[model samples]
Target: MADEIKPAAQQQVQIPVDVSNRETVYANFVQAHLNADEVYLELGQFSQVVTPTGPDPIVLSHRVIMNFVTAKRLADLLRRAVSQHEQMFGVVEVDPNRRLRVQQPPV
Candidate 1:
C-alpha cells in the first residue's frame, strides 16, 4: 500500500498553548531597547499630564526580552492584527490630540 502525501498547510501541526498562570497587564506605552543580540521591550502605562516641569512619566509594568528574529515575528503579527481590526472597524488614530478632539462633545 502507498502512503498519501499532504500539502504544506495540511502537513502543519497544531501546538497546544497553556495559559494557566499567565498574568495580564495593560500597557498604553512601550519602549524598546536593543543591544548586540537581544531586544528589550518595556511595557508601561503612560500618565498623560501637562506640567511646567517636563513630559509625563510612564510607569513600567512588564519587560519582555527576545532575540531579533522573534522580535521581527512579533512585529509582523502585530501589524496583521492591527490591519484586521482596522478592516473590521475603521482606521485607528495614533495621534493623542486627534483622538481627544474626535471624542470631544459639541458645545
Candidate 2:
C-alpha cells in the first residue's frame, strides 16, 4: 500500500514597525549636535536627489556627513557620495582640492 500523505497548513502574521519622518530625524540630530567642537569633522557627503520635472530634472537630495573614522574619512565620503548619485540635475562632481585624492580614482 502507498504511504499516506497530507498537505501542510498555512498561517498569516502581522508585524508592526516604527516609521520615523526623515525631516524630523534630521532636525533632532541637528539639535543634538548643535554648537559643539567635540564633534570632529570626519567625513561628509553632498548629494542632489532629483525627480522628473517636465523636460528637465529637479534637485532632490543634498546631504552631508560629518562623522566617521579619521585620516581617510574625507576621501572615503567623497568617493562614496558621488557613487550613489543620480543624473537628475547635471554632472555632479566634487572639487576636493586635495593633493592625494586628486591622483586616486573617483572610487
Candidate 3:
C-alpha cells in the first residue's frame, strides 16, 4: 500500500467569453509592427479620397498589441482557419486584379 501510486482527478476548466459589449469593425487593411518584445497590429479600412490623383487613405479602426508568443500562436491559428476555408470552398485570391480577371468572360 505504501508503494502504490494514486491517480489524480482530472478536471476541465471552462473559460467564459463575454460578447455583450463587443463591437465589430470591418478591416480591409492591416499593418503590423514589432519591437523588441511585442507585436502591434493596426487594423484599418481603405477609403478613396474624392480626388483621383491622391493615394487612398487607410482609416485605422483598432490596434492589438501582444507578445511574440501570442502573435505566433495567432498566426498559426489563422493559417489553419484559412486552410480549412480553402478546403471547403476554393483558393482565396488576395489580388484584386487576378480575381477580376478570373471573373471576366473570354472575349
Candidate 4:
C-alpha cells in the first residue's frame, strides 16, 4: 500500500534564517526599480541643501534585489505595519511644504 501525500497546508516546513553577520542600514529614501520578474531597491539618505534652489542629494547606502514574490510580501508587511502605526498614533503625511515652512523664516 502507498502512503498518501499531504497538501502544503497540512505539511509543516521549517525555514532557517541566519543573521550572524547581518548589516543594518538606516535609509530615509527608498527608490524601487521593477521589471517583469525582479525588483531593485536603492536605500539611501537625502541631504538637504543650505539653499532651497534645487532637489536634495541622495547618498545611496545600500541596494537590495529581490524577486516579485518577495517584494510583494514586503509591501504587504509594510502596509500592515504602517496601518497599525497610524491607528496607534496618527496619520503620517509626506508633505514637503510642512517641512519647508519650518525651515523658512517668517514672511
- Using TM-score as the measure, the top candidate is 4
List runs of model 1 lying over 4 Å from the truth.
1-16, 49-56, 103-107
Off by over 4 Å in 3: 1-11, 48-50, 103-107
Better of 2 and 3 by lDDT: 3
Error of 4 at 1 (Å): 16
Where is model 2 poorest over a 10-residue stretch in terms of lDDT?
25-34
Predicted structure with the largest lDDT when compared to the true one: 1
Per-residue lDDT of 2-104 in model 3, one digit per residue for the tens? 8878898898999999999999999989999999999999999987455666777679989999999999999999999999999999898998788777465
Tens digits of per-residue lDDT for model 2 on 1-107? 99888876776878877678544312111111312323332222224344475333322233343443442566687667766664444445445455235455577
Give the Cα RMSD of candidate 3.
3.5
- The total number of steric clashes, by the backbone 3 Å criterion, in model 3 comes to 0
**In candidate 4, what are the lDDT values of residues 6-106, reduced to their tens digit?**
76676668999999999988888999998888999999998766556787778998989999899989999999999999999877667987745645567
Clashes of each: 0, 4, 0, 0
Q: Which stretches of candidate 2 lie over 4 Å from their true place?
A: 21-57, 62-107
Q: For each candidate, what is the lDDT? A: 0.91, 0.43, 0.90, 0.86
Q: Give all candidate RMSDs, comma-separated.
A: 5.3, 16.1, 3.5, 5.4
- Model 4 ranges with Cα > 4 A deviation: 1-9, 51-56, 99-107
Report the candidate with higher TM-score, 2 versus 4: 4
lDDT of 1 by residue, 1-107 (tens): 89898766746679999999999889999999999999999999988886999768779989999999999999999999999999999889998788778465679
Candidate 3's error at 79, in angstroms? 0.5
